[model samples]
Target: MRLSVLDRSRVRAGSGHPEALRDTVAFARQAEQLGYHRFWVSEHHGVPGVAGSAPTVLAAAVAAATSRIRVGTGGVMLPNHQPLVVAEQFGVLESLFPGRIDMGLGRSVGFIEAVRKALGHDQEDAADFGRGLAELLGYFTGDRAVRGYPADGLRVPPFVLATGAGARVAAAHGVPLVIGSFRGEDAMIDAITAYRAGFRPSTWAEEPYVVISSTVAVADTAEDAWRLLVPEAWAMAHSRTRGDFPPLSAPDDVLAQPMTSRERGLFEQSLRGHVHGTPSEVAKALDHLVHRTAADEVLVTTSTYDRAAMLDSYRLLAGLYL
Candidate 1:
């Protein structure tokens, strides 16, 4: 099956305070026309580089602006939040958008040690990610017996964001599992096998659902797509391999920007795992993505320096689908 696009609502270059919100609304509207399935925002805090720190607030806006595309987190980092609060927030979203709302959960500070400590957590709080998962679900499923409350039986459905041990948690709880496609395909096979083998049906989820997110860039030409992808590609590679986000130059200006050999290595290896190329190339990658994850759905994590180029990329990919 063709892959489904999941917009990251990435902040545009030189974006103002409201730019991310405006881009999100516009992106959602345009994606509706392009035939994408769902548009998910990410979560980050104290990071000037990211704008999706409050995905729930933004998800409400996206839901109101678009009619068809499902809206939710690509993965909400649970370590920094309260489970009951998340449950209530998404619960209300579910009430408003109905079946169009998805609650993909995650287990990370999504920031860093300094930032996480500032946010009021110790290094050991990550151990409670499993507890946070249960609490968030209890709030959604009206499982008062478990520890959640937004007033009575009001509940929303939930999904798990599986990365490392999160895969096992998803399996144990029988929630939908979304492996971070930013990583690689090896863990995907391992996680999916684990989730299916260990799944236990829940009130919200029956069969095991696998929704892996991929950072995809499609354009009219391979070179053009690669050009549009440099900023995001550079940022992700720097974060994982080097512990920071590197400086990103303009698409037209990247030739002058210099990167170290190590930086290039990370950038290249990370790029190899993602879907980047023309529509035809992306289509082939997506086909392989489907078979590898055995995912019920594929969520395309799109990015660019600005919203126009990002929007163009998504539109082009949508055309490839039909």
Candidate 2:
């Protein structure tokens, strides 16, 4: 029944970044008021629809606005940033918020071509993601470097978000791991098993903490939830068919488009992997996943069309959990 915020940061094409930041802060504040456990921003670059490219800054802003809810990244791509800089930023965050910050690192940038270019990188430029991951952990844990940084003091606790059976990294470091694979329970469990086997107890953790982050929405009625979820489903469909940087489709638009070829494939893939429905429905899915995976917590992602809908989604979803 645990719940946290997963902001898709649904900014439209003409939406201003300042406005998005303001809206995001407001959303975080509301999440805290509603008693959500955390507000985790995502790292996306060169995506017009998502403005959370700098999760550290956004996380700090959210932390400053709210007193209790945890604030951190659903992920910061280690391949895209310097380990030292990430260490200092999250260290500052930990200093400011103390025990209320969580750092989730990922191996992939949240977008494709434009995102790569924005980060001044290319497919060929990708760091050995595993190596970069180790380096980032080193900066925080006082292990990788022989000199100042990896040997210095930083109090940030970092987790790895493993989407495709890579949770072993989390185990090796003895930090928490978040896995949100659609329904690849077998794969997810396998990774968790690997992670637990590889874990080395650390200052931040003696045992494993695994959280499941999945798509979620809730409404007064099943039909209503379906209606609200269409925006998010369509938003994702919009991304795969048109590419991953466009704003969401209008409900009517998604309804109008006949599922075909690539779009159909994408929709089926997402449905097989994601959790989407009314509070009761989502709760059912949640319970099923928890029963199957024994996840310690759940992170709910709101990727709907508008800010209001997203807020309402969490309000209802969390209410169901309560």
Candidate 3:
């Protein structure tokens, strides 16, 4: 039952991107002191709400700031960059951090068509993820046609951030799988089952490893914990409805806004499928979730407008296990 964090470097309303990024680095230091297993960052291109556009660079900053906790990306989307460049970037990281770096890879392209074009990729490019993954792995193993400098013979653990089909890719590659819990329990279970069924032994992993990424908010009261989810939920709703993801707003501000039926529905939907409650309640839900999915680790990915409250939520969650 390992507990980890995946901070998106979320930009809060009234704050600049620099502050949000500095917050992430500072948050990693706190997370390390709190005894978390890993502290991972994320990548989002052209998303206003997310300041972590370059996860590898952010990961380096986090590693430099912390002593023990593992540092890596929640992931870097493979389709947007050349595998060789990605390998070199991580090669430099692993060389610097040694055993503390992880490579979490994802297949997602940019969020919108314009951003996708800017990245020189489109939706269809995501399908090439399998090929790209192989190339990236080959660099580390020195199995590719070209050598990847410091990357060759470097053994940085790789984890695939996947859904159903992506889970199959992870299984085929025989690396660890990092799946989200947002998509309903049944669907998540099915994906895990498929992943285990198709898993093959490779240098990366001898058996299937599953890390369930989830939104977990803990507080003194159930209502208070639920309130921590509001800002991100509203931002998600805004992205879906208005096609723009704004910085996180205070819970009170979000609650006071008038919304169309569609916006309201999406906002409500975003709030569901999370583990939020008092410490005891959240623990119970997480225990059940781990039991059902047989997850090797739990990656907490909770963001809110209030930084202090957010850190308190993580502190409470860490207290449950540490």
Per lDDT, the best of the predicted structures is: 3
TM-score for candidate 3, residues paired by index = 0.99
lDDT, residue 140, candidate 2: 65
Worst ten in a row by lDDT for model 3: 122-131
Please, what are the lDDT tens digits per residue for candidate 1 over residues 1-322? 4455555555545664367667777778887788888777777776655666788888899899999987888677787788777877877887778778888777777467788878887546677888888777766566656544442365355778776678888878878888767666886788788888888887768888888777888888999887777777777766876665534446655445676888777776655666788889988888887877778877777677756677788888878774
Q: Model 1 Cα displacement at 16 (Å)?
A: 3.4
Better of 1 and 3 by lDDT: 3
**Regions of candidate 1 where Cα sits further than 4 Å from its true position:** 145-155, 237-248
Every model's Cα RMSD, please? 2.5, 2.8, 0.6
Cα deviation at 132, candidate 1, in Å, is: 1.7
Q: What root-mean-square deviation over C-alphas does model 3 reach?
A: 0.6
lDDT of 3 by residue, 210-308 (tens): 999999999999999999999999999999987878999999999999999999999999999999999999999999999999999999988999999
Clashing pairs in 1: none
Note the residue pairs that clash in candidate 2.
Answer: 182-273
**What is the clash count of model 3?**
0
- Please identify model 3 stretches exceeding 4 Å from their true place: none
Q: Candidate 2: RMSD over Cα atoms?
A: 2.8
